[model samples]
Target: MKKILRRLRRFIRRLLGIKPRMVWLTHPVFLQHEPGGSHPDSPERIRAVEAELKAQNIWRHLQTAEAGEVSDTQLALVHSRRYLHFLEANQPPEGKIYRIDDDTVMSHDSMTAARFAAGAVVAAVDMVMAKKAHNAFCAARPPGHHAKSGSAGGFCLINSTAVGAMYAIAEYRLQRIAVIDFDVHHGDGTTEIFKDDPRILFLNVFEADLFPFPDLEKERGSSPNMLHTPFERGASSLTFRRRIRNEWLPVLGSFKPELILFSAGFDAHRDDETGRLNLHEADFSWLTHKIVQTASSCNGRIVSVLEGGYTLTPLGKSAAAHIRVLAGKGRGVDVMRYNRRLKQRT
Candidate 1:
């Protein structure tokens, strides 16, 4: 019955020439990557998000695409050739796991999965640039914000967000692109990759004294293009929203970005044990809505890539809320269905 109703809605929209503006990108290799030994960056993370989106009946409403693998040459745009070659050369045996650092590891198929994760972002950029979609969410695994140009850290193998940003600049000649990261931990890798590039503006907010780089809290005022907002432990929802509105929104409006890429991390959810900050699903919806309104002024193009979300239930719920707003679903139930019911009653 649900499937039938969904198809009916699609058919009616087609008749009215109403096309969806949001695209959801995923790849099977995301599940194939094994980080090994109770690592928080698990395949189950993507599974949880998928299940929730479907459970909320949000999955069938948008266009879905399988992400293709990124090419080595394209990867070289942001990553070092030596690092790319090293990642290519170091693949563990089928049964073994290779540890890149204390926090990151690689299984036999990890490289393939990493390439496809980056590929999802690349595909999303192409879709939005071509105006095929207003925005996209890449739900692939092995998050990329932590991976630098030359090395991997904090479970990221390839810097997929950087790849997508560079791809947009190179392929579309876009200037003044914006990358906003609201993850629990600092996006040290993204900062390192884009700190020198004047074309890109990187805005990041993370928990102070958390994992990765605690010193980033002190260096917040150093870079002109890079803006950092570090929250102390147990920061509340009010603090989160207030800071974003005060700090991120003004800069975003003034920058008037050609494209906005979100490192959409949900680990800040209060229930998630990975991060100490406190945020809820409603906050995420509000954030996405604000981003959408900002995008409305500048061609309405956004590409959101998943970063860090550890605990299962909150991760799923938070991601659904974010995707819902991206799909223009708003904070309430589906508006189309509500309209149809009202018409029937009338």
Candidate 2:
């Protein structure tokens, strides 16, 4: 009876031409990306996010889809054949853990998780391009913004948003696409890959002196498609919003990208221990509103893939704010509660 009612509701919505949907992509394989104990980035992050969204009943607003693995062709969109070969060669055997760096570690299943994480974003691009859903978010891991073309670090193994943007450009023939990285860390990997490609606008805001930090500032390429806004540690919400408004909004206004892909990382939240700069759920809500508004003006298409939120409590709260906003749900307690929390923390 419940299933019948759901089907009937879908039919009615279709009949009414109310086909708005915020598709969320996740996969069980994402849970297999355990880096080790005491690591900030763990499988528990996904669990916490899933539990909160379910408890809040936000899933009702989302068109949840099981994410798939990225095809080799899709990986080829961003990663090189040699790099793919290197990652495959270094993948750990069953029940074994291999450490890539002081912070990055991979178990046997980590490769699968990384591939699917990137694939989830690629699939979200397909869904948006096909109008299967208005916008989509991939709640997968390990996070990808920190992963470079030939290397992975900062708990990231694959550059998902970068790959998805490339897929949209190559497959869907999208002329201009913007990748907005609000992960509290610079997306050096993404900038590295798409430095010279004018087809992409890689705009970001990150806390200064963070991990996987890029030595250079912005893209030094031919067409100039990248912008970086760095914040000092302990920067308040006012500073955060002000800089983005000044730096990103104008660039995005002019870029008029056909699609927007977000490297949505909530690690900047005040409660998160991984980073020093403080942000809150309300900030995330406002940020989503800005991005949604921008996308709406150009083309109502966005694909947000998970990147770097670690602290479970704040991660869940902030991600809920982001996803709910994407689902067209108004910001709830996040508007005031998290703002107060942010003030307290900072």
Which numbered prediction scores highest in TM-score against the true structure?
A: 2
Candidate 2, residues 1-346: lDDT per residue as tens digits? 7547756766787889988598878899988877778888888888888788887788778877778899999898788889888788989888889888898898899989989998899889888887778899898999888778887778888899988988888888888998999998888888778887889888878887887665543333333788878888999888898888887888898888899999999999999888888777889998989877865654679899988888899999889988888888888764767667666876
Give the Å error, residue 335, model 2.
1.5
Error at 49, model 1, angstroms: 0.9
Q: What is every candidate's alpha-carbon RMSD to the true fold?
A: 6.2, 3.2
Judge candidate 1 at residue 27 and give its lDDT: 87
In terms of lDDT, model 2 sits at 0.84
Error of 1 at 182 (Å): 0.9
Deviation in Å, model 2, residue 218 alpha carbon: 7.1
The deviation in Å at residue 291 for candidate 1 is: 1.8
Worst 10 residues of 2 by lDDT: 214-223
lDDT of 1 by residue, 17-130 (tens): 886568888988898888875899888999999899899988877877789999887899989999988888899999888999988999999999999989999999998887
TM-scores of the candidates are: 0.90, 0.91
Q: Pick the candidate with the highest lDDT.
A: 1
Where does model 2 exceed 4 Å of error?
1-16, 216-223, 336-346
